[model samples]
Structure formats: structure tokens, C-alpha cells
Target: MDRRIDGLRVLACLMVVLLHVSSSHIHEFGPKWWSANVWDGLSRACVPLFFMLSGSTLLGRSESLTDFFRKRALRILPPLLLWSCFYLWWLWHNNAPTGNWLLAILRGPTMFHLWYFYAIAGLYLFMPVMRRFYQYSTQQEKIFFLVTWFLVASVYPTVQSLYTDVQCGRAGLLGDVYQLQYFGGYLGYLVLGAYLAERRIAWQKGAALFAVSSVGTILLTYWLSKRLGMPCEFFHLYLTPLVVLAAAGAFIAFLGQPAAPSSAGLQWLSGCTLGVYGLHPFVIDRLLISRGWMNSTGWVWIDPLIGTAAVFLVSLAVIGAIRLIKPLRWMV
Candidate 1:
């Protein structure tokens, strides 16, 4: 793999951390006009990029399913469990809903971040066979799969959500493999990343696709928002053409950079990204809320883009500080 891609991987992870920061305090960036819808709108791209990068990196790596599962589990599950404990602890301290004691143990992560870890782990267990099938797929056949994926994953759901006021999510029997297809909307990204990473698609062409699609998304999203009075946010849609465009553009744009030799500072921050992702919500939930950090400016009527960078830097510091703790240094 190219070092540039690894650098992009780092960027994408940072994007997720920053995304959580902004979400933790929606009052900050949520009101700005040009930038109001941007962060949350773009934040969805961050994790999708991670998935896509994961697909590309892991799919053709020639590891056995057992080996792949072992590696993937170690990489994600430990931190997930660690943070799950932290959130539940926080809830217990606050006397809030921690679920039934048994349910708390079963559900683990108290916030939404855990779902990312769960979904990724679920996908990891199944990727070996998917990879084999992917390898056997002709170019046309792959496109067909992608087309259906986009429709089921993004287009259909977006249309449905627009017409009806309801939330749509993964649905299937408890033990169903197809339950994973609920993540199908996300597969557009994962598959795109895998396709590009596998060298099945040319880099230049990918960049071009990204550029054209992203510009189109920005324009279309803006037009749709003005026309329909929609927020252009992603909540109502499973996947949007706009999100696919933005994420693809952002991923490629970041990937286009050359990697610098890792400085101790940069590498240290990189090492702390997982910790940052895990603990950021707790900070947002407990500290940010309790600390009274809400934007107090009367200028919000003008669409101020507040707290975008502030939340990220603050969260970065908090996560970095966690490494100094002797007992928990292993997780970060």
C-alpha cells in the first residue's frame, strides 16, 4: 500500500474524531450557513472512507478468515469494550439510563460510536467469502452489484425517507447474514475503495469521478435545500448521491497527498486516534455539556460556523492526555 494512502487513512480517522467533536456540540457548528450543514454533512464521509479503505486494504491481502478475524478483532474490539465500560461508568455515575444491568453488559457502548465498531467487525467476519466472490466477478458484474448497492443503499432509502417521516435502519433476523446488508448503503464507499485500492480502477479516473461527482453533489444539495427547505443533512437518508460524492472526493483528495516521514508528534497523535474516537463522546456528553461551552454569540442569525475547530482541538487534547494514564495507556 502507498504511504500516501496510509496518510489518507490517518486523515479519515481524524475526520471521524473531529466529526464526533462537532456532533457533541451541535449548537456550535450547526447554525452556520455556508458551513452549517458542512461538517455533519461531510462527517458521514469519514467513517465511510474508513470502511472503503478497510475493504481495499484487507480484501486482497490473502489472509485466512480466521487470521483476518483475529487481526480485525484485536484492532477494533478491545478499544470498543474499553470505552463501552467508560460510557456505562459515566452513566452509572450520573444516575441516568444505563439500560438494565444485564442489557448494559450486552449492549456495551452507550453511545452511537459503538455501532461503527460493531458494523465493521460484522463485515470483517464475512469479507473473506465476499472477497472470493469479488475476485470472480467480471467488471460488468461488479458494476451491476454496485448499481443495486447504490439503489438499495442510497437512492431508494433517500427517496423513501424524503416521502415518509420515519427512520430506516438495518432489519433482519437476529442471526441473518443479510442483516449485514443494511450496511449496503455504506457498501458504495467500501466497494469503491476496494475497487480503487485493488488497482481495478485507474487513480486518475477515480479522482476525476470524485471531482465531478462532488461538484455535482454540492450543487444538487444546495439546490435541493433551497427548493425544499431541507437541511441537506444526512439523517433522513440511508445514503445520498451527495454523500457518496463528497466522501469519494474527500478520500481521493486526501490520498493525493504524499506522506511525510512520521515525526514522533504525528505518530503519537495517530496512535491516539482510536482513543480519541472512543472517549470523545464521553467528553462531549459530560464535560462539554456540563462546562457550558455552548456558543453564546448573537451572530448565529448570520449563520456562524462556530466550534468546528475548537471542539476538535479540545477533544484531541483530552484523548492525548489519556495516554498519560498509567493504567489505561495500553488502549490508546
Candidate 2:
């Protein structure tokens, strides 16, 4: 295993927790919002980084469709179903308003964060073909594919913000008629990941790109949200140009680092990332914020960070405990 990938998993998992912890305060109009915005902005790359990680790790493999589905189902479907039910019960327990849990789930995730499961499931479904492409394509062709995806998937929507009157027909023509839609979506990140993993990047260059893109994302989000007189997620989107750059920079930056001494502790923490991701929201909503324990500090920076740390650690401990039980381990 690449220790760097393990390290990246832990970092991305923490970012996921921080994104949720700070998200509650982001809608407020004041200093709290600004602080939350900063935290949230920095964490927006979490999903993209995760997808890229999947790309790097999975896209290089050759497996039968049966084997692929079996492997992916073991990791994804059980937890998705179990967590969806758990959150449904949690929502009802809290008297949080919702409807038709069955339908809500069939349409998408019962909870917001679980949406990643759905997206990744879709990617997994397509991975067999994607893997073949990754295996057979020339370097130039791969670059061309990424360029096309970036232009259509990342650049096109970005342009829509500038040109409010941009026609869907024109986009349709470019997307459908040109067949560029095939190259769109999160698949590009997977391809990019596979490509980057094969090459070595200078840590200095990766760090510089990460720094600039991170700051740019924060500033752009703040200005846009303030301009709109409400919380805006334009720059927070994973597919947006700024966020794509930030995630790519982050992926390479961390992967470029010298390997740290092997630690079972780090490996254990990395293995628990998925479990922590599923359970942290429950910790946040029920255990922390609902009890008025989080965001209580007058210090903006301290509040979200503390809440994130608490949720992450609690969720990690819970997952670790669960993993010890033979029957329940598969759910996580």
C-alpha cells in the first residue's frame, strides 16, 4: 500500500468532517459565516480528492465484472442501505421533517453526505469500461480526454455564471452533438488520478498550486455569497474549475511527500474512514450541535475545528469498536 495514499485518506476524511461541522454556520450572516466559509471552502476538495483517489487505486486494476461488482458491493451497498435506514430512524427520532423514506432513498440518498455513495456507485458501475480505456489509451489520447472533460464538465458551467443567458441548446449541441458528454462527469478525475499516480510531481510545485487554488476558492466563494446576499455554493461545487484545480493540487501535493515511517495506527485510522464518514453526521447532529455543545465557543475558528475533531474521534472510536464484532463489520 502507498503510505502517502493512506495519509491522504486520513486528511480527506478529516476535511469531510470539517466540511459538515462548519456547514451549519455557513448560512448565518456575520463573522460566524465568514469563519465557516473559510473552513468549508478549504474542505470543498474532499469529494474530488476521494474520487481521484479511487481513480488512482481502482482504475489500474483488471477484474471480471462479477468480481468487480462483488468487491464494490461489499464495500458500498451494505453500508449505504444500513446508514440510510439509520439516518431515517435518526430523522424520525429528532422529529426532523421528511417524507416517504422509501421513495426518498430510491431517488437518492436519505442523507446529504450519503450522496457520495450514490455518485461513487455510478462511477463503479462504469469502471470496467473506464479501466479498459485507461489500459489501452495512449498518453496523448488520455490527455485529450481530460482536456475535453475539463472544458465541458468544468469550464462550461463556469461560463454559465458569466453568461446568464447561455443557452442550453448550445451546450446540448456541444455536449451531445460533439459526443463530449461521454468524457464528462467525475470520470475525468479517475483518469487524471491514474495518470498522476504513474508520474512524480515536485512537492514545491504541488504545494504552490494547492496554496493558490485554496486561497482563490475561499475568496471567490466569499465574494459570490456576499454579492448574492445569501450563502452560495457556486465555488463549493466539486466539478467547478477552481475546485477541480484545488482537488488536483491537493491530490498531487500529498502524494508527492516522502513516505512516513509505517505506523499501524495510521493504517487503522485510514481503514476506518468510510465508517467515520457514515457515522459523523449522527454525532454532529445528535451528540454535538443538538446538545448545544458545538459552535458554543465565541471563537469562530475554535468552534468548528473542535466540533470536527470531536465528531471524527467519536466516529472513529465507534467504527473501531464495531469493526471488532464479526457480524457488523461488513456494514461499515
Candidate 3:
């Protein structure tokens, strides 16, 4: 992996932690709600960045389908299943009324964050086909596809949210006729990652895009939420226009960085990020509810930052210990 990509993984993991930590206060309408919202909005790029990173790394590979599945099965499947079961058990232990163990695992993620595992698995299934498409497609065709995806996946939803009563029945029907949904979703991010990875983006350009889109996201989210008289998430959606730009900008910025050999510690932390993600929610639950750190300092603004750092470090420690055990290390 590119050392810069590793840096991105580490950064994305931190942003994910910050997002979850800040999210708890989004609905509180407390004194710090706006601050929390800002953090949340900024951190929304985390997931998209992860998807892009996956694309950059995966789509260019020349492995056979059998080889791809063999690798994924060994790496991703076990962790997905084991973590799903673990979370289900955690929920049951918390008296959350997990209906059926087998069914729950089959039904999807047992926890909110576990959804990413399922989604990645779905993407893995289509990657072989996507790779062929990417391999054969011309640059202009890819650009056209990406633009169409942006219009469908990002711009359309934003328009709908802004103009709830404006009916586009015929246009929507036309979209359905053409199956535009096929062009939308996280698949675009995958292709986008592969596409952008081949280019050399200037650091200044990437930084400018990141700064502008991030601020736009913050303002747009605040405006939408206030207009709707609730905590609106339209602008925060991973596929939202600003978020797409932000994720792309961030990825480009990472790619634009001057190359350096990754330190042993940075590589170790990057390897630990997946485990940190899987375990952080549980750690957060323990800290906020079990340890009463939800309002630790009585300053809402300060609490989320403190809590995010604590959860991330605690999760990393737990995962580090897990990595020590021979049989369990693969799951991380």
C-alpha cells in the first residue's frame, strides 16, 4: 500500500471516531449542538474516503476471480462474521432484545457501524466485473459515467430534499426506465478512487477543494436543519455533492503529499484501524453509559473531543491485546 494511503486510513479511522462521538450530541439541541454538528459534518468524509481508498487499492489488481474471493474470504469474511456475532452478543448482554442470532447475522449488521462490513462485502462481489469494465473503458467514458453518477446519486437527492413538493414524476420515471440506480451508490466512489489514483493532483488544488467543500457542507447542513426545524442529515449523506467533493479532495491531498517511508508505528496503527472501528462503539458505550463520561467536563464542546480520543485509544489498546493472541489476530 502507498504510505500516504496508510496515512489516510489512520486519518479516516480517527474521523470515524470523531463522527460517532460528535453524533451523540446532534439531537441534544444543547449549547454545543452546532459545534458537534460541525465536527460531524467535517467527519462525514470518513466513509467515502475509506471507499475511495479501497477502490484505489483493489480495482487495479490483476488477480483472477477465484484468487480475489480466496483473499477476501480469508481476510474479510471471518472478521465480518465474528464481529457480527460479537456485536449481537453485546447487544443481547445489554438487554437490547436480539431476536435470533442466526437470523440477525443473516439479516445484516447487528450494530450500526457493522453496516460498513456488509457494504464492503457487497462491493467485493462486483469488483471483479467492475475491474473488467475499468480495464476496458476509455477515460472519456469513465468521466462521463462519473458525471452521470454524480448527477443521479448526489445532485438528485439534494434537489429532492430542497424542493420536497416539486414533483418530477416523469423525470423520475425516466430515470427508473434507464435504471439510473445502477450508476449510483458507493460503486462510483470505487471507480472514482481507481480513476483519481492514476492522476497526480497538486496539493494546493486538493487543499482548496477540501476547505471549500467542508465549509459548504457545514453551512448547508446548518441551513437545512434549521429550515426543517430538526437535525437534518441531507447534506451529511455520504453521496451528497459536498461530501463527494470533500472525500475526493481529501484523497487527492493525501496522494499529493511528498512520499516518505512509513514508520513501523504508523503501519501498525493502520493495520489496527479496522479493529479499532469494530470495537470503538462498544468502548464508547462503556465510557459514556458505564463510566458516565457523556458529560465528563460539563462542557459539551470539550466532552466529545475528550470522549473521541478516549474511545479511540481504548479501542486500539483492546485490539492490540487481541492481536497478541494467535488464533484471534486474523479477525482484527
For 21-40, candidate 1 gives per-residue lDDT tens digits of 44432333244543434444
Candidate number of the best lDDT: 3
Residue 73 in candidate 1, Cα distance off native in Å: 1.6
Regions of model 1 farther than 4 Å from truth: 21-35, 99-102, 165-183, 199-238, 257-265, 296-310, 321-330
lDDT of 3 at 240: 82
| lDDT tens readout by residue for model 3, 1-332 | 56898999999999999999888767756688888888887899999988999899998889988999999878788888888989888878878999979899889888899889988889999999999998889999989989988888778866775776533211253267777778767889999988988888897788789888989998998887788888876678787889999999988899888878788888889989999999998898887758888779887778888888899999999998999898998999
Model 1's alpha-carbon lDDT is: 0.61
Model 3 TM: 0.94
Model 2: per-residue lDDT, tens digit, 79-198?
Answer: 999899899988888798768887877889888899999999999999999999899999999998888888888888577754574432133546767776776778889998888877
Q: Model 2: runs farther than 4 Å from truth?
A: 96-102, 165-173, 259-262
Candidate 2 is scored at a TM of: 0.93
Q: Lowest-scoring 10 consecutive residues by lDDT in candidate 2?
A: 165-174
Residue 284 deviation, candidate 2, in Å?
A: 0.5
Q: Global lDDT of each model?
A: 0.61, 0.85, 0.85
TM-scores for all candidates?
A: 0.76, 0.93, 0.94
Please tell me which model should have the higher TM-score, number 1 or number 3: 3
Query: What value does the lDDT take at residue 70 in candidate 1?
Result: 78
